[model samples]
Target chain A: MRDVYVIGAGTTRFGELWERSFRDIGIEAGIKAINDSGITGNDIDALYIGNMSAGAFINQEHVGALIADYVGLAGSLHIPATRVEAAGASGALAFKEAYLSISSGMYDIVVVGGAEKMTDIGDEMANYITSMAIDQEWETVFGATYASLQAMMARAHMERYGTTREQLGMVSVINHRHGALNPDAQFQREIKLETVLKSGYVAEPLRVFDMAPLSDGAAALVLASGDVARKYTDRPVKVKAIGQASDTISLHDRREICTMDSTVYAAKRAYDMAGMGPEDIDVAEVYDSSTIAEIMAIEDLGFFPKGEGGKAVEDEKIALGGEIPINTSGGLKARGHPVGATGVAQIVEIVKQLRGDADRRQVKDAKIGLAHAVGGSGATAVVSILEAEI
Target chain B: MNMPRFWREKQGRYNLVGNRCTNCGTYYFPKRDICPKCHRKSIGKMEEVRFKGTGKVVSWTIVHDAHPDYKDMRPYIMAIIELEEGPRLTGQIVDCSLDEIHTGMRVRDTFRKLSEDGKDGVIFYGYKFRPVKE
Candidate 1:
C-alpha cells in the first residue's frame, strides 16, 4: 500500500446552523478544503461523504449524489461519490475510505467530508432518530435514549472506580477553556466545575453541561498520494496508520460496561501500525460526547491506566499545556458534536496543531497526533495516527 | 414502526423469553438464532429459555430528557438488570423513584405499557422492572 497524506482541511463553525440547509454546509466545507489545498474542484478525482441520518433528519437520501451535484462535480467529472455511515463515527469512516482509496492507488486526489443538519428537526424527534444507531428493537423500543445509555456507563464507572462527580466536571471545565480559545467552536465561553454541578440533569450523573449539544455543521479533508502531496502544500500531515473496529451494538451485550473494547482494539492496532505507543503522541483528539465517555476513552486509548482517567483529569494532566494535551479543539464537549461532522472536525483540529496554526491551544512542538472517534455506545471505533512531514 | 415488526417481538417483550447456548452455556435476551460466543457450534442447538425475571440492577439512570414518544414518561429510571439466568437487559425500573433506585437492588420483571403511536394507533406493551418488595 502507498502512503497517504492530508494536504488541506476545513470546517464551518459548529452550532445550530438553522438557516443553512444540509447540502449548503456540505458544499461550503468542500470548497474551503479544495481552496486550502491550492487545487480547483476539477482536480478532485472522487468524493466520499459521511452523514448519519439525512434521510430521517431532512427527508432526503442519496446524499452522495446530492453533494456531488451541488458541488459541481457531476456529469462529465463523474466523480464516484459514496456515503458512509456508522452513527457518530460517520466522519472518521469516510476519512478512512478516502485514505484507502489513495493508499490503494485507486485515486490520487480525494475529497472526504462529513455533515449533519440536526436542528432541522426538533430536539425530541432528533433524539428518537439518533437512537436508531443502537438496537432500535430492543434498546430504543424500551425507551432508552443515548444519554441514558451513557449515564449507565457513568454509573458503572463511578461504582467501580469511585469516580467522583467533580472529576467528571473537571473534563467539562478544561474543555470549555480550550473551546473559549477556538473561534469556530459553538460554546466559546469557559465554564466552571460549579456550573457543571449545578446544571439540570439530563440523565442522572450526567448534567446538561456534561453532554455535548446537538449541533449542525460540516468538515472536510483533502487527501492525496504521498508522492503528489508536495504539489498541493509544503506542509503535509502524513496518515501514518488507521484502525477501525466494531462491538455489539447494544450496551447490554457488552462484556464490560465501563470499558469500551472496540476502542482498546482499534487503538492497539493503530499504535502497532504506527510503531508508536500512546506516550509518543504529542496531541490527541478523542470522542467525548459525554464527560464520562472522555474518561473511558483516555483509559481505552492507553493514555491513562484503567480507572485512573478521572484522577488524571483532576490532576490537570490532560489539559492544554499539560503533560498530554487532549481535546484542544474543545472535543465534542464544548467544540460541539455535529454527529457526522465530529470525526472529521477532530482531524481538522489535529492538522491545525501539527502545522503550528492553532494559536492559543497549540501543543508545543507537536509532531505526532491521534484522533479517536466512536459510534453509539462504543459499537464502532476508528483510530488514526498522523505525523508532521517536517 | 410497522405493526408486524412490533407484533413479532411480542413474545420476548411480553414474557422474559430468551435463548441459551448449549455449547457455551450462555443465555441471550430477546433470544438468538446463534450464540455470539459459540457461533456456529451452538447454531440449531439453541434452546428457548424462560427467565425467572429476578435480577439485580447492574447500573441505572434517571432520564429527564427523552424521545417525544415518552414525553409523559420523563424523569423515568432505566436500568441494566443482570438476570438470574446471567443475561443482561435494559428496562425501565417502574414503581420506584430516582432516590429509591440503586445498583445491586433486587428487581423483578413486570409488564407495562411502553407507548402508543396515536390515539387510535397500537399501544405498545413491554417488560419493565420493579424493585422487589421485602
Candidate 2:
C-alpha cells in the first residue's frame, strides 16, 4: 500500500442546526472541501459518507446515495457512493475506507464526509436513539441507558482507581476553556469545575455538564494519493496511519468497564503503523463523549498509565501548552458532538493545527497528531495518526 | 423491540441462562453462537448453563434521567452484577436505596417488568436484582 494525503477539509458550525436541512449542510460542506482542494466534482473517483442514524434522526436511509444525488455526481457523473456506520466512530471508519482505497490504488481522489442532523428530533427521542448503540436485548432492555452505561464506568473507575468527580470535572473545564477559542464550537465559553459538580445528575457520578450535547453538523475531507497530492495543495497533511478495533458492544460483556480495550488496541495498531509512540504525538483529539471518557482514553491510549489519568487532569497536563495537549478543538463536550461527524471533525482540527491554521488553539510547532473516535460505551474505536512536514 | 425478537430471548432473560464454550469453558450471557477465543472449535460446543441468579455488584449508578416510558423508575439504581457463572449483567437493583448499595454487595435475581413499547405495545419481562438474604 502507498501513502494517502489529506489535501483539504471543510466543516459546518456545530450545534442544534434546526433551520438547516441535513442534505443541504452535507452538500455545503462537500462543496467547500472540493473547492479547498482545487478539485472539481469530476475529479472524484468515489464518495464515502459516515453517518450513524439518518434513518432515526431524519427518517432518511441511503444517505450516501442522497448525498451523491444532491451533489450532482449521479446520473452522468455516476460515481460509486457508499455509507459507513459504526455508531459514534462512523466518521473515522469512513475516512479509513477512503484512505485505504487511495493507498491500495483503488481510487486516486475521494471525498469522505461525515454528517449528522440530530436536532430534528426532540430530546426524549434523541436520547433514546443514542442508547440503541448498546445491546438492546440485554442492556438497554433493562434500563441501561447510554448515560447509565458511562455512569457505571465512572463508578467503577472511581471505586477502583479513586478517580474523583473534581478530576472528571476538570475535563469539562479545560475543554470549555479551549472551546471558548473555537469559532465553530457550540458551547464557546469557559466553565468552572464547580459548574460541572453542581449540575444535575443525569446518572450518579455523571452530571449534565459532564456529557456532550446533541448537535447537528457535517464535516468533509478531500484525500488524494501521495503521488498527486502536491498538485492540489502545498499544505498536505499525510495520513501516516489509521487503526481501528471493536469489542463487546454491551458494557457487561467485557470483563472490565473502567478502561476501553478498543482504544488501547486501536492506538497500539496506529502507533505501530506510524512507527511512533505516545511521546511523539505533539497534539491529539480524543473521544470525549463524556468527562470520564476523556480521562479513560488518555490512559488507555498510553499517554498516561492506567488509573493515573485523573492525576494528569488535576495536574493540568492536558492543557494546550502542557504535555500532549488533548482536544484543542473543544472536544465533543464544548464542540458539540454530532456523533458520526465528530471523528471527521477531529481530523479537520488536527489538519488545521499541523498546517498552522488553528488560530487560537494551535499547538506550537506541531508536526504529528492523533484522532481517537469511540463507538457506544467503548465498543468500537478508531485511532488515526497524521503528520506534517518537520 | 418487536414481539418476536423479545419472545425468542425470553428464555434466557427469565432463567438467566448463559452459554459456555464446552471447548474452553468460557461463559457468555445473552448467549452467542461462537466463542471469541476458541473460535471454530467451540462452534458446536456451546451449551446453555443456567446461573444461580445470585451475584455481587461490581459497580452501580443511580439513574436520574430516563425516557418518559421509565419515568416512575427514574432515580432507581442500575448496577453491573458479576454472576457466579462468570458472565456479568446490567440490571436494576431493587428493594434498596442509593446509600445501601456498594461494590461487592450480594444480590439475587427477581423477575419483573422491564419495559413496554407504549400504551398499546407489548410488555417485556426480565430478571432484575434485589439484595440477597445473608
Candidate 3:
C-alpha cells in the first residue's frame, strides 16, 4: 500500500448552530477544506461522511447522498460517496476509510468529513438518540445515560487508583484554558477548577462541567497520496499510521471499567505501525467526552502509566507548554463535541498545529501529533498518527 | 422500544438467567448463542444457568441527568454488580440512598418496574439490586 497525507483540513465553529442545516454545515466545511488545499471539486475522487444520527436528529437519512448533492459533487460528478457511523468515532472511521482508499491506490484525492446537527431535535430527544450508542437492549433500557456510565468508571478509578475529584476537575480546567485561546471553541473562556468542583452533579463524581455539551458542527479533511500531496500544499501532514479497535458495547461487559481496552489496543496498533513510541508524540488529542474520560484515555493511550494520569494533570504535564501538551484545541470539553464532527475536528486541530497555523495554542517544535476518538463507552476507538513533513 | 425485544429477554431479565460455556466453564449474562472465549467451538456446549441474585457493587453512580424516559427517576442509583456466578451486570441499586452506595457493598437482585412507555402503556419489569441487609 502507498502512503497517505492530509492536504487540507477545516471545521465550523462548534456550538448551537440554529440556522444551518446539517447538509449546509457539512458542505461549508468541505468547501473550506477544498479551498485550503487549492483543489477544486473536480479534483476529488471520493467522499466519506461521518455522521452519528442525522436520521434521529433531523429525521433524515441517506446523508452521504444529501451532502454530495448539496456540495455539487453528485449527479454529473457521481462521486462514490458513503456515510460511516460508529457513534462518536464516526469522523475518525471516515478518515480511516479515506486513508485506506488512498493507500490501496483505488483513490488518490479523497474528502473525509464529519457533521452532526444535534441541537435541532432538542436536548432530551437528542440525548435519547445518543444513548442508542450504548447497549440498547440492556444498558439503555435500564436508564444508563452516557454521563452515568462514565461516572461509574470514574468511581471505579477513584476507588481502585485513588484518583481524586480534584484530579478529575483538573482536566476541565486545563481544557477550558486552552479553549479560551481558540477562536472557534464553544466555551472560549477559562474556568476555575473550583468551578468544576462546585458544579451541579450530572452524575455523582461527575459534574455538569465534566460533560461535553451537545453541539452542532462539521469538520472535513482532504487526503491525497503522498506523491500528490505536496502538489496541493507545500507542507502536508503525512498520515504515518491509523488504527482502530472495538470492544463489548456495554460498560459492564468490559473486564475493567477504568481501562478502555479499545484505546490501548488501537493506540498500540497505531504506534506499532508508525514505529514510534508514546514519548515521540509531541502533542495529542484524546477523546474527553467527560473529564474522567480524559484521565482514563491518557493512561490507556500509554501517555501516563495506569493510575498516574490524574497526578500528571495535577502537575501541569498536560498543559500547553508542559511535558506533552494535550487537547490544545480545548478538547471535547470546551472545543464542543458535535459527536460525528469531533473525530475530524481533532484531526483539524492537529493539522493546524503541525502546519504552525495554530497561533496561541500552538505547541512549540511540534513534529508529531496523535488524535484519539472513542465510540460509545469505549466500545470503539480510532487512533491516528500524523507527522509534519520534514 | 418494541414489545417483542423486551419480551424476548424476559427469561433473563426476570430470573437473572444466563448461559455458561460447558466447554470452558465461562459464564455470560444475557445469554449468547456462542461463547466469546471459545467462539464457534463452544456453540453447542452452551447451557442455561441461573445466577444467585446475591452480588457486590463493583461500581455505581447516582445519575442526576437521565434519559427522557427515566426523567422521573432522576438521581437514581445505578450500579455494576459482580454476581456470585462470576458474571457482571448493570442495574439500579434500589432501597438505598446515594450516601449508602459504594464499591464493595453487598447487594442482591429484586424484580421491579423498570419504566412505562406512557401513562397507559406497558410497564416493563426487570431485576434491580437492593442492599443485602445483614
lDDT of 2 at A293: 96
Give the 10-residue window scoring lowest on summed lDDT in candidate 1 chain B: B66-75
DockQ of 3: 0.85
* TM agreement with the true structure for every prediction: 0.98, 0.98, 0.99
Model 3 ranges with Cα > 4 A deviation: none
TM-score of 2: 0.98
Over 4 Å off, model 1: none
Best by DockQ: 2
A122-182: candidate 1 lDDT, tens digit per residue: 8888888878888888888888989999999999999999999999999999999999999
| Clashes per candidate, residues 3 or more apart or on different chains | 0, 0, 0
Question: Sorted on lDDT, highest at the top, how do the candidates line up?
Answer: 3, 1, 2
lDDT of 3 by residue, A314-347 (tens): 9999999999999999999999999999999999
Clashing residue pairs in candidate 2 are: none
Candidate 1: deviation at residue A86, Å?
Answer: 0.1
Q: Write the per-residue lDDT of candidate 2 for residues A1-390, one digit (tens) a residue.
A: 988999989999999888899998899888888988999988999999999999999899999999999988987799999999999999999999999999999999999999999989898799999888888888888888899999999989998999998999999999999999999999898988888999999999899999999999999999999888989888899999999999998899885799899999999999999999999999999999999999999999999999999999999899999988999999999999998788899999999999999998999999999999999998999999999953
Instruction: Return the clash pairs for model 3, or none.
Output: none
* lDDT at residue B134 of model 3 (Cα atoms): 71
**Residue-level lDDT for A39 in candidate 2:** 94
> Which model, 1 or 2, shows the larger DockQ?
2
> lDDT, candidate 3, residue A13?
91
